[model samples]
Target: MSQSATTTQNPRNPDRHQGLANGGTTFAGVLLAVTGLLSIFRGIMGIAKNDVFVATKDYVFRWDLTGWGWMHLILGLLVFLVGLALLKAAPAWARTAGVVLASLALIVNFLSLPWHPLWSLILVALYAFIIWALCTVKRGHT
Candidate 1:
């Protein structure tokens, strides 16, 4: 068989495409970890009733600060773990997990916009970058 046919036929061929370089993956991993850490800190602040966050009145998405705190804490932990995983020689599943977690983080930060407008906006942008980086990998590149 020709080289091309042989490579195509072998599912586990090393010549198979593996999307994204080590650098890109590493960047995404670092970003995820940092973002996750920030979220965790934000969660703790919210839970502790820190005066840093402004109280919003009459907002449609109004949720108890404590409730949001717990939400962020749990979600942040998950994201952080996923980020750690990505830092290693992550598998395909890790990439998918990273994308999912980043998207969730973006939503969570958006919901928190009223409390800390600038910080929330920054996080939203960061998460967007993480999502983009994770999703930019071509299919076939591991």
Candidate 2:
């Protein structure tokens, strides 16, 4: 039988807290928190008229940067809260919420790609990883 069907353990690493034994949820939680914080900072910068973000002029989805900032701020706040909730890995609902929030993050990052290409793409990748991490874990495994 394959490994996943039988067990969630790494044969090479007996350290339960490190590998799939822990489902990488702990790492996901921490990364999500950091990503949220970064987004929050980016939001503040956009709201403050800081020229830190380079927005495209002739983009298809052009809008007031302030509005985008607000979206980022709200999304980041929710993501941060969900990340914190995932820390305990107690309530199953937290995982569900995390997955949902990660999906939203992906969309937000994709939409903001014209504003900041590299960072937005990076965040998209992070959100994808978060979604993968959240989805891979079996209930009660984390």
Candidate 3:
């Protein structure tokens, strides 16, 4: 058989073919999805107890807790959508957006740590993982 015939007949290797050329992107996408869900849950909780939570320990800031809750809700929704897109083979821009959003989440959670210290810490850590996963793609492999 000619080289062209073999190349066209079996272009891909079933055993080696993965969803993404680099596994880091897939892992990062999964992390973003999970974290987005968590953010949605947390935002709902925040909105549910906006007043009491805000009143506790004089944690009131310039913006209302409910407003913050809304911000988180919107951000979470966007992140979840982007993550789904990433899983569905979105373009490189989507992946880059994920990284930027995750970084923003990290900063937001960090600044809000005083309100819910433990949960904020958890989110910060998760965001750190996301950033790491997104940034640590295999060099020269993709």
lDDT of 2: 0.80
Q: Candidate 3, residues 1-142: lDDT per residue as tens digits?
A: 9976775567494323333435757777887888888778777877888854543455555567787787788788878887887788787677788889999888878867777788789889988877766665545433
lDDT of 1 by residue, 34-106 (tens): 8778778878988998575788887779888888888888888888888999888588899899989889889
Per-residue lDDT tens digits of candidate 2, residues 9-96? Answer: 5555454434552557877788778888887887888888847678688889987898888888888988888888888675768878
What TM-score fits each model?
A: 0.80, 0.81, 0.72
Q: State, as a TM-score between 0 and 1, how close model 3 is to the true structure.
A: 0.72
TM-score of 2: 0.81
Best by TM-score: 2
Number of the candidate with higher TM-score, 1 or 3: 1
Clashing pairs in 2: none
Task: Tell how far residue 38 is off in model 2, in angstroms.
Answer: 0.8
Instruction: Evaluate residue 37 in candidate 1 and report its C-alpha lDDT on the 0 to 100 scale.
Output: 83
